[model samples]
Target: MLQRLAFILLAGMLGLAALLVLGIGFDRLSKVRQLDRLPITQLNALNDGIYATSGRVASDAGSLTAPYSQDSVVFVRYLLEEEYTNSKGERKVRTLDSGSSATDFSLVDGTGRAVVSLGLQISQVDWQIRQTHRQQNGSRIYTEHSLRAGDLVEILAHFDRSRQRFELPDRVAGLNAIVSHSSLKIEGGKSLLIAGLWISCATGLLAVGLAALLVGLGIHRYWVFVLVMTLGLMAVLWTIGLVQLKKDWQIAADLYGRRSAAVAAAPANPAALADLYAYYLMIERSASQWPDSLLFRMAAPYSFRVPTLPQDAQNRVRNRLAEVQSSRFAEQNWVLFVVAACWLLTGLLIHFALRAIRFKRLVEFIPTSKTTGLAYGISELFGMIEVDDRYPPLLSSVNQQKCVAYQYRIEEKRGSGKKARWVTLDEGGASTVFWLKDALGRVAVNPAGAKLIFPEKKVSHEGKIRRTESWLPPFRSIYCLGMAGIADAEASRLSLQNSADFGMLITTQTEQEVVRGQGALGFLLTGLALATSLLAGTVWLAGAGSLTPLDLLQVSLLVPLTLALITSILHYNGLVFLKNRVDKTRADIATLLQRRHDLWPQLLVTVQTFLAHEQDLQTALRAVRDGQTGASGQPQNIAGQLAHERQVMARLEAYPTLKGNELVQTFVAQMTRNEDELALIRTGYNNAVELYNNQIEQLPDLILAKSFGFSAAPMWQG
Candidate 1:
């Protein structure tokens, strides 16, 4: 049950991650296309909406120095990261420091200059300098990237007149405020650069997701469900966030309407005038809070102390405010939608993590013990790690520790505190096919594609450099689960040419011990998932906000239903993983048998050709010596034929370079290759027959085999 659950969860997680990436990619591609259509305008003729503008970043004496490169720059964002491994044997990259700085700068187009605010969003800044510093710690390394001044840039932002600066309107709160309140602002083309960055980020994420999905989906169908569910949930949540943003816009508009009416009434008394001035000041302070047209008209009448505006003017102002607010509202909803999508993505990751623990438990099911005497097909074999001459061992990269297989990584800290992160500098590993020795005998084991596990390792640090390494030292006990057979030799080994399947693993931990650990982890994940689901359901029930009891009940029921559905899917996937092993075994046996059949005819023809060239005197003597008589005096048996051919070859070897003798050498070469293949086929066929026979003769598996039409296969006798 645990194994099945884990398989399903893994499949689902991988699938969801893939779909999320694809959706992000499509969305990014659309944005990039939109940005591409934007015309680059001169600073003097800059419009209100988001548009591209190219200009030289005005260098100032007050511009700050970029940290790493010491370059003079108007703005810079720096980050430091460090890498470390947690107790669970997983490597984690953490941020150590990060900060950004900016100053007011003027953007100069060929025609004119526009003052731009440095506070505008900058998506991807071209870093003038990126340098790596090797710290004393063996496990960690550091690198830095920064942007400097005097760089040519393309800017995208709405030109705002209030702050007298170009800014990212999306960064501000409220739909009406962003659309009707703030004007386009740019400083070094940062805001439009931000838009380009978002599109690129989406595209990158989508590529990763699609690659992961394609790789995992080939192993199972459960990933398909994962992708569909993750995308569906994200879409639903995004729509909800947009709806909320729209509601906020309506409330803001209503407040603006009431404030506008009071100003137009014209106060007569000092108390009334004081009240009106107080209201005017409040509006002025939060200038971006109201619609653009409304704030402008409100300021003009009140700032100039106009007693009463014309009726036609008031209607015009009101209509213009409504039109501007509607456009802003639409514009603002996209930001909310992105936020909702990001939140749902985070939620899905958490969900996948919870399920991953359960799936990991399935690894414990891989067999670990003495497999020498057992019938082959697929078997788990246990042994101690050893080295062989075929592939020599090498010293580990970081620590110089001698091992048959070693993997190492180096990371550096970038930024400080909450904004810090660890980035990888260099990483690689080397491995070779080695030996696994036990009481049964020494078996040739392939370490390639094996999930290697090592003992606890302490990291060594020297100054800023840190290093961590993992290796399989000689004499360490190991477990391998794969196809086992004794081919052309006495010792039994697995015919593993590539990486093993997930269900079949090669690990250092014992099966029972690993199972116990994975089981504990699975239990914890299950508890967490259940608690989260229940909490979500309770929150829905308690504060559905004006929703009827029936509607609330429907929403509440969905939580458990969804949970149950997920569990069922995982369980079903597990069954598939288990059943596939049996099917694989059958297929392997059939393949070996087919190969033997194909090779036997070729071998026979070669032997016959060699015999036909020979001119022998003892025909009757040979007939009598070998079992030549078939039913009604036909040809000899295959074994008898092979014996006769060997005798002929022995006689011909005496005559060097003869026509028939040359044929004998060719026969010997072909026969040697043919014999090696036959030996492997014979061993695999015999083992498969034994395993199949044993399975059918057993209890539960016997019933399954019978139901599935797993009849006995003939063993090779020749």
Candidate 2:
């Protein structure tokens, strides 16, 4: 049987170990796959375009109108400036001027090549251009431009294909050509296959390791099954990551090669250059919205390189760059890292905890030695003891140790089995102990035990004392006594004679101490909590700084700490206050009881006189109605009865007592209930005050509060 159990446990441990490994593997694979699919290049291209546009705007003039022609035709004129290299490799400048009415423009290159190109009509007298250019150095540029009427123009001379590049302007010297580039295209091969294999192998190994660890430690049976299923899921995710990584790697390599070739083949046509910039600008803009994608990073610069006809386009680009930098994009990365770290730490802690619980091999049980010397008996069975060599009798054990005796009151049914009659026991005395036997002579250890129970108190020569009577119902079958002792025949006889006298004195003293303690503690705690809360609020309110969202979050974090500190201080103060109040109240109650006792004789005498006055009044009224007295005699009798009535009323009204005594039975009861409610209200007020004060003192509110010279509000005392 032991071997089978061991085998089962081992199998479970292995299963759990496999599951943990699989979960970790799956998470890593998912992250890698997400990174692979990111459009980094595209984002990069867009970001660059925004920067370049702003830069160009700062240096260049606004758009201008084309001049009029002699044929009564309105010719819209604009300049396109570009740099190019001749066949001799010398840098040269090219300019192309087009008339709105002209259908063609001619360009002469430095090498005397002449080129003629047909003009395209642009409407709205508004110049809008979008372009894409691939440079020789393997960089792509995308540009977008919009120019209003009356903007300044700088023209670039173009190559004339017919003349074989023969144009030179005074400003053309030393101007270099703008080389263009394009993105590379990738295809499938061996590299992709290798990448996939690596991913699969790594994931499989992780899954297997996790499963083994889980199985090594015992977990719920359901979790073992879950681990098995998780392994398969992890494998599928790993495969997906492998495929994505392969695709991105190929694309990155291809893009690099294509950019180089595009830059080498130069175009002297300014219109073509403008068109290239505009196209790339669009591409870059599209990528900015996808910051996480790898393509955005690669494509972003393309937007920066695009040339603009007007200055405003460059300004727009520069503004975008500033915005991106100002956004604190880098900070977000740090935030993500911190959050992930925290989650990982939490998960690790949970895993360790589970492992600790599962592998707990130590067996612990109650020590039988601790129960030795304690009385062993069913508490309800009264005197009958189940004597065990290892365990002491319950009552006898507590008395000998000077430990408090606890008894549980129980209700047992006679006939109906389900219902029970409530019974109290004196477990310590002989009479109560002797009644524990059942019909068959077996000692009833359960509800049938009618053991006498005693309250805790110091035992004196007088008797085993009762400390206080609890008006509240006894909890379960338990009652407590001060000391542990077995009530044998000798002890029982002596205790019965002196118990009543001993009990009264102890009960009165105990009641006073307990009540006084509670009241004093409550008051002290409430005051302290309130004070600490206010102090914390004041300190926070006094600090200075502009409060951003992050600052607000920091302040919010402090809230719980502040609350905890305040609560602790309050609790301690409350205990002190309650203790003091309880002591004071107890003294007051004792005095009142003493005064009532002293006044009892006088009160009884007054009651007898009042009863006599009532009898005299009845006699007087009967004599007057029967006309049995003379007129003068009747008046004297009436006066005597009236005087007696007044005396009785005066005695009843003149009783010296505490205020509101008629409404309350005892001073202790009145003060306890009243002080308790007051304490509750005070506590609630302090909490509200603390919360409001803290909120106003922190972060965004704190900034506003300081500017206005706002101070922390005081807590309510009531």
Candidate 3:
């Protein structure tokens, strides 16, 4: 009965937290809507409300030097942190310094320039990292984000015509503010990445956790219950670990926001107070909206580990850690130490598992391209391995089968009876440079830094010895996902290799098979994690005596429900991601459409330069300029732009002289490129809408969508 009551209480807490997270997601979606409604405007032709403008950063005032890198820049913010493992074996990190420097700068587009004052609190700047380095400690590094001269940046900010400066609007606490890169992509609220983690871990772990919960409940063993409770404990600590993980960025942001807020408050302006909060979100929002681990972020850039300060001052700033004390009589909680070890192991497993899941999703998200159609950036290809005939093929050590790549293990039986185990006699693998071939073409593949998971496996027994082998035989179908770049430019062959931008993965298994294999491995690791947690609890319980069913009931109800709520946030976050994608694409389309209107004069002048008839040109221009709103009810007048392009084409055809005219041809080609780009953006917007609608229509997510009144996003009919 006591356990039942605990469940009820924890349920309330879970529900409350869920509601809070849901509220944040909903609020972000609303803000995205507002920003989406606004059009991108040039600085020279500024409007009064929220809009995005792209321009080169320039300022008359002398630039400030970046603290560590010493680069002269208009604005710079940096954070320095040190990380080391503590006596408890827990990862510990401390912030040394973090701050921002800014000055009034002008955003210069060819049309004109607009003054962007640092006078406000909310400098919602997604300052790109200017300089960085790996520290001597090799753990914590500081990043310097800045706005340097000649930076072509897009700023989504409110331009208060009355104030003649860009500032956060007083009406909303959240800025619809997003830099183009903010995918700054304002990426719907908290990053969808977090939502994705919540969803994947929530759904993945919840399913696995419940299965483990069932096994525990069925066994009804006190030790078993202890294991579940132990995991619950680690779950809490894992959160603390994550917090410690993001602390540097968080601290720096907070410090900047607080100091900026204090200064902004002196003027008694609403926008000033609003900006204080906005800067806090810049780092968080600037993250890519993808379903990946938060722990997988790039290490901060370089900063000197040793301070230039005197020894005494340095000692004062960097306090020496307390020495770990030894005591024979002191009672040590073995559970803490044991769980820490298990947690670390579990973390590594989770990281590997998450990578598999990420790759699986990438396979689903990005369509496989023909070899000839591969882009220079991240690409996926389907093909068969074609050996480089110049070199002899790698022969499998076990079976002596001719192969392109192979791994074999030869093991001998050791010991006897209950202690008998397999002792490896020898194990090795070999990879030869090869080509991936499809119907269209083939590309060279370098196997350096690749994680190869082959499909075929064989285990053979001979007396007391056993041999196991897996290999990608020549002509077998293969799936290659990696960074595609130039290998031999003159030969016109592309090379597949690992780069900092994307990971390299080579698999003989099909995409579906690879995904399933990853799922199974993740499940096995999760089960092992449960086993360790249980072992930890059992070890601790050996000294502490027993547990009751009531205890199991009390703890089980609270942890799973909370974990469920935490993880299930994926759908909502996915919705936010989709919404942001749509918004970003919409803004882009609007910019192109506006360019069409802006470029008509150039097109008209080019035509008039050689030909006659001003009346026809003016008439076509007016038709194209008739701004018609799209289905989304935004000011993106796609119809008018379409009419203008159609008119340009029809008018051009009327004159034979304009067909091959150099300037006329250039304008025509530019218009064609614009049309193609606009088509792609429209397609992207529609895709986002479809995903959004599908998410809201799914189970449980549908309930949340209804609660939040998140209706289906309209497709681009424009």
Candidate 4:
């Protein structure tokens, strides 16, 4: 249920993001279309209204060197960055340079020029360079990025013809005008084709929304069908948008070409413009001299101008386009951010999907096998529990249920309502090597790391905040899967041989519910992987090269096919890690089995020896009753089988080595100690399993278990 909620939330966010991008695309496209219809005017035509024009920066005023590169620039801004180490030993970089700019330059057209006044706001300019230097103690300083001189500029400003200060002849004076509005806004290059971009973004948004709706409506099983259909429609829309963009570019180019040609052919004779220049000055002076008349007020803001050469107009248009392109390149933050988000989501989905796949394989490949005839490698084993009599049996602290091994935990609720949480007060569990007997034979199991999915017996107390105790009881038929190998042993040992590199360890409890969970995770992960991969591809292609969002859809249209290949490689690596863990765990289990195998024979021998001694002592007692008492000393307490037997023999040194009932009690005690030692050895094997399982389950270390495939072993119970 949590997963479903998370998924739905993510989908909603993505949809909203796409919608936002689409809207932005449409807005930009609208601006571009407006620019196309806007009438282009020459600088010589003075008027009192907003006007768009392009020109080159003039070095009429003194220049300052760009902070980083020290390049001469008429107007520029830059940032200085300094690097330092913080208290946490992390390196950080911060801007140290304050913003600076110069506006003491002039803008000139082929026919006339305007002296740009000081204190007027300039448009946003990205003219800066970056540099870095190391201090003696290894500190570093740098700049980010910068712009320099010779850059073309396109601007929209207010023009006023009444504020002219220069005294030129009537003809030239009429052409002179004042331009105001300090804040200059850099034009975007793609602004011309913005309408086409808008259409593309809107179409893309619709495609995604449609796909999402279909999937939400239960068409998810045939996701490829939805993807193919949407992609096809999107492709058509994109083609149309691109075609429109191409046409606009061609139109602008043609206009520039014609203007250039016209300028080249026009005669440069001053007499051709003499009549118009005289007429413009007479009208301008008359407009200012006379007021309150309809014609005077109507023509008051108009300034006549001589026609400039077509070549010069072409140059200005070309410069304007160049400036637009530069600005567009700089304004790519939105596109880059969207692309990054796509990659991040894709990566997350792929990561979880791969983990699910690994776990699924584990559930399928590991078959539950019988304890008898179990192979010497990692294998699943299940059987009835048998406890060795020598070692103490485990008793649950909560209910005091007897078992070979058990674990219990105590938890209490700490907070109330939504903030409530279960906090553990104290917890611990212990295990010993227990017998798992089937029809054929028995196998020892160590249940340390296994996710013990058993019928947990819980006891709850309605106290301050509800305390609960849960436990994994013993004696019931349980299953386990982990590393199985031979353990170290003496030469005379039979070596039941289980684990090697590490000891017996349980990774997970074998239960039916866990198997079902594995299957569910597998299916979910597979679906997520496919969906995320497609999303990444679509985002990459749709947002490529500054493409904007359609009304409701947004993404790049360019894709790198190698992303799929990389994902495959990552999955392979994950599989390799799992395989390695399985192999190691198998070796560890085998080592314990080997030692147990060797100890079994030695234990049998000790039991046989004890029986033989008992028989000999009985015979000696019979002799003593028959009036054949030996001249041996008093009997001593027996600490060990061999020692007690020798003591009995020494007492009868005058007679044969066979003694009487003098050491009978000692013999029984020796036998008991021997049996206990044997049980302890088996317990040692169980402990090893517990330790190995624990190491894998530790946080951070648990990452290995989750990724590399280390399953916990079930404890052996007698």
Candidate 5:
């Protein structure tokens, strides 16, 4: 039973595989055929035909046309005279030499002319003798015109030469001739057989899919069956693709040959439309040769004689044709084909290989544990909670605590799976875990407090709790608090750092920032450098005639190089200046941070000391006056000035006896406000400095500075 089942499974799989392979092969073949359509190939052919015909006509015309002739006359022609009916139904006959030989003639249109001369050469003929016709309801008209000495010709030729007449023929004739004379019909039919094999292979792909499914269901020994079927299908598709390609190649080659003949026979005078057609033919021939030759080389088991031009002027022709030959073979179609084929094969192989494996053990091993009671169900019910406040409820629960009952509700899902799981509670709830339950009726664990039960699984909460004395560390928070007061000092320091007077490193940092557009200083340096470089170049060139080659090289090279070096030095100096300024700014900020740190601790002490002597007139006055004495003494004494103003205010408020003394209190109040304003100005300066420093360090400006050999400034530090 097992063996039978395996066989059946294998057969189905092979059938499906065959179908898929054949389908893909045919699809590819169809695409190839579509791509080979007349428009694309023929358009290319037309261009080549024009070029080749022009060359031949020009070559024949020799110096008469020389440069212009090579480009002017597109094709050569030979005329064949015969009587034909005109558009008015009148029969006319005219004798004229097409300039080549007789015998290359063929019947063309059934118009007034018996044979139409078609090529660039036909344009050489006088227009009076040709017929005219209107097409598309008179939208366009074709007329015969006379050729002048310098006029251009574009037409194909027809021959009337006797024994040599049939020497070379148009593409269509060439194909007919080959078919009639050769016995390759049987071989050609083999392509049809190959196509059939492809169809069969495609059928097998479908079979493979079916077999794989059966194997997954426990059929034994199916793999061996799959392997044999797959291999056979692949072989068949390969053969089909190959054979079809060969057949197409032969067809293209035959078409190309006929076109070449037509171009060769084209008329030289009165360049006709036929000449363009002939030129198009030549292009097709050249194109066809590439694929045919390539495939023949690759597929042929034995050495074959490669086609060659006829012996009369073969060497000269080959040499002359070298450029065209090279260009033609380098076309992209063949490369595209090879790439497409490789991709197709790779995809097919991967697909079939995967199907063949049919491994289901991995899937079968997955676990599905069920939670007991309503615990899981209730948990799921509580999982739906809205991240946004407005949403419908999924479930509701109540839990009692002390004298209050907390009400909770589950809302819509916030997200998916574990991430989505959530629960919401009414405003009065003390704990969310008490009322929640899973589908299995077990109590749901509260993730926030459950960590105590499983301590190892709990996230660490070390950083959360802390003494409330301060929210941030002293140095870090002081900058934020005293920004206004310190900013001006920082800006002044930064400016000094960018100045060239500070020497190379600081100046260079500044220049780099300017170049990088990080600071105003860099911009100034960049402009100066550009102007200097230009000036140097101009100066070097001005003395050009007076200098020898060596002298010119020395002078010119030195000018630019020297200027660049100077610029680099200047840039370096700017950076150093900027660094120095940054350092100074850092110092100022450090001082402010230190004062803030010290001030915070002294807040209670200062307040208590000032308030203790509040009622003692002499002591309070002495304290206020002594604080004022040292307030303005130091340049960096903002803290002292503030302390002094505080003491004076405390003295007045406590004394009341001093309230009527407006002058002293007023002076102290004004000083306090002035200090605050100065602090704000300093903050603004610091921010500006930070912005300038940051700008110099960013993109574009940074890139510019680096290009100019400018280095970055150090961060302001004290």
Candidate 6:
């Protein structure tokens, strides 16, 4: 049986790997769907931040010579590959070199041309030149992908005013900065197909492996591994959940305490009453994370309405907020707690099961439509939210960001240390008409009387008070199900409004995510419900003398196994957190690199204006700024520009008059701050890398490290 378990373990690992691949495929599919929704922006009238646009390829600094093809082109990428026979007599190919020309290029649209950087992910290369030849080592293949003067390509990135070029957008930092000739729709379709293939092939293998593993296990020990693993995972999840619940409780208590004090201090003040309402909404939001037990929600506010300020500010259930001191979650009744736990699990089972079925049915049967193709009836939309610029935007209380619709909330805290409890203070929000936009077009969407489904509530804490906010921020992609009607009959324009049957449903989740989450949650809850019942029955039977001590004690080995597994899990989690910290540091470096964008360009212009008389020096700087190289061969990229700035600053300091210039002095001061920021990023990044590397290389952790393939990150010498 043990040997069989070992074999099953190998198969299970393979299945898990296959599942991981499948998950990646689904993720890619989701990303492709989202990418397809972005409307193309005109190059001339570009957005201030990230935008996608298509244009013809051109170059200001003439064409670059393709190393392999020897053809002159505006921009080019080449891949050198060598074919070889593997140990298993299978044909394999390895890339010898994958390099691209390092030069600034131009993307010309109908309106205008924008400067583009070469370090972009060439997703759909034209591959103008392809050659194969027999070499001394092996059969060599050389492919050159060229972007000539007339070739149209799509670029989705932010315009860097400092370097005067476009790099990859920070939002999609996880993906390659894709530059494709194909339309976003076409590209997305291809990506979806590839993802389907990945899921199909992987799923097939996983199914077969699991079948064989199950057969090998036979009758007696059939579900032993599955049972043990499930139980272990459940324990871990429960532990995490308990900790989270405690945190939520503390947050709620903090808000309630403050709200009570505020109400007492200024009971007649309408401002204080509004503040009280905001606190209730936030308290409700926090408590929503807890189980839907009647007792748990006894102290938590049901809901709040922050109507036109000072207009008889009222709450739906005033009792929930008014008597907020007593919380059922704080009570330690063992019997009541047990009963609540069972009831909670049962409720979750029913809720998730129904949701899984209902959501699946609705999505599959209701039919989805683009904003461009809206009819005068039901419409299911997957697009981005666009705030109607005509109206003043609402502000989120926590982040304080501008939004189309928002719920601003604040909770007041009172009491000392562990005895603290929070009360509702104030809550306010706006949900007016907005636009639902897709790649094709945009349509009006009235959020009034709509069922808004926002996932995360932005939360923050300040001395004696807590604030939580939820909002439909501008350009937030969403999946909406609502009734459509002809708003402008003459124009034949449709608008999303409340339906008599379906009402209006808007969520900040993609359709695929919604389906997956619903299905996964339902399945897990069902299993948990069954597991709970089984355990309860077993305990009952044991107490009733239906089972002997030996029968009950048969699984004694689980004790040490559970302990060892728990310890390993803790270590593994620590390592993962460390790795994430390292990743954050790397991301922070990229963010810090852009901090001096506005300053750098201004500084450059100021310095050049200061030295108006030095024609030779001016000419030299222009040449350096362009494609021309100086004595140090000044780099043209942002990093290289920083180095060049250092040299120029030194030259400026050498001249007393130039150094004293007011504009130069201001820029210099700002540049010093920028340098300090860069210094901190460098320090943080390298330190995180060092710590992660050490953790992965250390004793007990290294076992999991190697298993996870945690290779050491390169140290930054900067």
What is the C-alpha lDDT profile of model 1 across 1-718, one tens digit per residue?
5555564455466446534543443232223323222334555544333434567677543677766556676666666677797765589888777766666666677877766664444433222332322232455444444334455665555455344456643322121111111222212122223322332333223323332333333322233434433454344334432343333333333433443344345334333333333333333332333232344454455342422445565454345333221101123344445445544553564466445533443444333445355344455677887776754667778787767778887877777666567777888888776677789876666666666676635476665556777877767887666655434343223443233554345678875545544444433343334334433432322221211122223433443455455554454444445555445544554443343334334433444454555435234224433433311111113335445545754654564443355444555565455445445544554554554565566654465556666565554455
> What are the lDDT figures for the candidates, one per model?
0.46, 0.30, 0.54, 0.44, 0.31, 0.55
Which numbered prediction scores highest in lDDT against the true structure?
Answer: 6
* Candidate 4 segments whose C-alpha is farther than 4 A from its true place: 1-311, 326-353, 366-373, 381-424, 430-444, 453-468, 473-480, 486-563, 574-718
Residues 221-315, model 6: lDDT tens digits: 21343453345433432443344344434434443454345345533555444444545443453333224233246544532223234333555
Using lDDT as the measure, what is the rank order of every candidate, best first? Answer: 6, 3, 1, 4, 5, 2
Q: What is the lDDT of residue 3 in candidate 2?
A: 34
Q: Estimate each model's TM-score.
A: 0.39, 0.20, 0.37, 0.38, 0.21, 0.29
- The candidate, 2 or 5, that scores higher on TM-score is 5
Provide the lDDT at 587 for model 1.
Answer: 55
Encode model 2's per-residue lDDT on 43-139: one tens digit a residue.
1121111011110111122223323211211123333445677765677756543233222222222222122222242332222222212222212
15-97: candidate 5 lDDT, tens digit per residue: 65655655554443332232222221111123112111111011222222112122222222224344566665677755433
lDDT of 3 by residue, 94-158 (tens): 88899887777778888777777655543455443444333444786767777788877777776
- lDDT (Cα) of model 3: 0.54
> Which candidate tops TM-score?
1
Please say which candidate is ahead in TM-score: 4 or 6: 4
- What range of 10 consecutive residues in model 3 has the weakest lDDT sum? 321-330
TM-score of 4: 0.38
